[model samples]
Target chain A: MKFSDFFRKKSSGDVAKDRLKMVLVADRSACSPEIMERIKNDIIDVLSKYVEIDREGLDIKITQMDGEGEGSDGRTVPALYANIPIRNILERN
Target chain B: MGEVIVITSGKGGVGKTTTTANIGTGLAKLGKKVVLVDTDIGLRNLDVVLGLENRIVYNLVDVIEGNCKTKQALIKDKRYDTLYLLPAAQTRDKTSVNPDQMKQLADELREDFDYIIMDCPAGIEQGFKNAIAGADRALVVTTPEVSAVRDADRIIGLLEANEMKDTKLIVNRLRQDMVKRGDMMSAEDVVEILAVGLIGVVPDDENIVVATNNGEPLAGDASLAGQAYMNICRRVCGEDVPFLDLDVKKGFFARLFGK
Candidate 1:
């Protein structure tokens, strides 16, 4: 209900798309965005790990739902939301 | 009636532009007059890939705003006798075009061309809607990677809500070596997840970089990846081409190599 209020202004199509994407992200990562936030916070705690992740460049993702056409709804989810671009390779190189 | 098919993906760099360029060329090669429109708007790269950037005089924005005739905005491909490209307005943003306007433009183009291929931008935003608005069907491109597959799934859900039922899937940039090693997901694994009819599986090849650099598509060649794309093109034309296993059994070195 609270989430719906935040997205009230969005069109039905947009809302559906948003929900589907977010949920799939959660399912894939097996971690909610909040969990990701905690992970980020913990990483920030270990200030001297090896290399610092520029928070701005911290891209974390999990495969929630992949484009599995019209049938076999929620068939076999790959169980991971795969993108979290850790660094700009070109910039580093 | 001419069909409008949007080449789209939820994530970026999964070869929506590449698919658009090649499938458009393939359709044209078969003698169907085709127009490939780049709907990425702000980040326009289709023109460069098709090698038609140097010839662009007008673009989709011009055609939509009535600033120029559709023919004037369209850059006909020099390579294929029947193919044409409606390049995006690189300077303009996505807001410059809307769904209604896009549908109008596609309708206008349909009168002459047998096929209209729209190269869609990444994400589920206004650009995606505009790219899909005029289309009778869509091709959602993704890679075997978890992120790309996730995004493709979201795109499929959106397509369904929008009532675009004829959506198909194109899994691009597949690493056959990784698949054989069980380090990466196989085509069967991806299709099982996405649940869409498989259109094609493109192996990630260095030749794609070379082909894009030279403004030529590898679909015409006999390379393994090239043959896969060609098979996809045929499937798009309603041909039933069985998919080849990218990780099928092979000799010693080949097994180690995943070829």
Candidate 2:
């Protein structure tokens, strides 16, 4: 059973709306899911440029942005934003 | 003994200096002796904001260096007999002062004034640490924008780490029309994310520009934003004033667009 079904099945539209709000909130603050998508896409693109991409193995995580020493000076994003793992996409000569 | 309060915003240009100057003036106008400190270091401007630049002689650095007495370094505001300013050094960066110096200075300033308002520089760098070093309380200024809100959330976390027991939020530059159209973050939305007590809500007004150019401030009185400031000051003093109108007339498009 999907997680949505655990609490009385939610409509697809409801889930999407919730996702949009969460996404926008995160995006405006520069830590939303869309950002991870962008990074993952870029990484996949670069990897494809070298060898065939491994979509399933491509691990991407979303986290909050950290403003450690910056203080609150810019857009309202979380401090200590997130930690993302990057891979080497060197085209073997 | 006076309470030391630092008006800070994680983001610059969100009105931390303006809030400090105006709140300092407001408290003074309330018959309380207040002193304003500019902690922006090399980018000093609280003096200019308060129209006390020309009167500065012995600045904060001079006093910190023991070149002059703290009393001598403090500029007496011409507009108010009780108000004063300890202007920051325009030539020096944030490295010139540290937390110890700020705590000692606040301890000294407490002897006479009813309030000491420090205008913090932008960012969570050395300047920020120094500004809040002696603060008994803090007022975080923020615009309704996402960036400012995000910065505020982060600052709140830092303040907690620094052990600042008292914290309040002041949302500046709010446009009620936009909120009416759901195009802007409602004050509720901001408060929801920051999760700090709401102190004041200042409207985006041209009067703020007029006040700045005229060496005046929105005191949360005469003007919409001014009146908001006044309420914040009152709330700081432990008053339970209701929220300001922040009232809006839905634009025609807002009306036509929905309920």
Candidate 3:
């Protein structure tokens, strides 16, 4: 809203929160980014059998999402999010 | 029967012993019979923190090894008649006591005390397991730093895995002025990241160091941090006490005079 505010450096508190958000997701899931990369490759290898996916645009990450259903009570739970751009679906016999 | 509570922090020097001493003294001040158990084993210091080092004849190991009766080992506090201490063995390691021994010891202590606050050792090891062995609940202490909160999250996961689900978080040494200036994380921020219930938020006060040096707990003292600990004691007793408003700005004259 203010001209000078646009150039202000991000607060350290916000920086800590952001870093923790990213780190905790990996910690809770017990899946490091290196392991995630290997898993992503495996997924690509399997999915390539029946469909064509855009490898360049592929994205995958472990993140926090709101929970639903019994006993969840609107708690935030870790979820695996994937965005694989599908180029084509192959016809199966 | 008394409730057994363990004060733990996965990282060292985060105020676990100080919190234990203050909480135990605070509960005793409230007319509750309290016992502070130091489970740091070879690195025992709770006795020193509580100013009971000169009174230790028999310790936890002495009782566990049947060298002395449990009654013979407890050291009554000089300040509070209702408060006592079961100090850790300075010469023995954590393996000196097992989980079953700790459980039996806890059950025995519960019969006489209203609250048994155990000061757990730092790190997730045999010592940590021993500390939580007989605890009915846990209070995970952590500072606002990323490393401390991260270790606390790990400790929470470990506690849950052990089926110790009634764990709460205490954010210690929080600097309100720094938080206001966005140089430090607030208690709310730490709690949100850890996803645990907040029991207390203690400010970074020089009074705590002074009290530690003097071997006096600040729980019932006339200081802000002391008031915070008192509030935490009431909360532990199921009292619906509200948290202190630590965000109060300095008065004009105080700020002007740099008081």
lDDT of 1: 0.80
* Residue-wise C-alpha lDDT for candidate 3, range B22-54, written one tens digit per residue: 999999999999999999999999998889899
User: Which segments of model 2 are wrong by more than 4 Å?
Assistant: A1-93, B248-259
DockQ for the candidates, in order: 0.03, 0.05, 0.74
Q: Residue by residue across B49-90, what tens digits does model 1's lDDT show?
A: 988788989989999999998888888897888899999998
Please give, for residues B214-245, the per-residue lDDT of candidate 2 as tens digits.
Answer: 77665745777788888777888888999878
Winning candidate number (TM-score): 3
Off by over 4 Å in 1: A1-93, B247-259
In candidate 3, which residue pairs clash? none
The 10 consecutive residues of candidate 2 chain B with the worst lDDT sum are B177-186
Ranking by DockQ: 3, 2, 1
lDDT of 2 by residue, A20-89 (tens): 3455455445545676688778877766676665576667654344334465543244333323343555
DockQ of 3: 0.74
- Interface RMSD measured for model 1: 13.0
lDDT of each residue in A1-93, candidate 3, tens digit only: 457657888889889977887787778899877899998999999999999999999999888898889977676788978999999998899
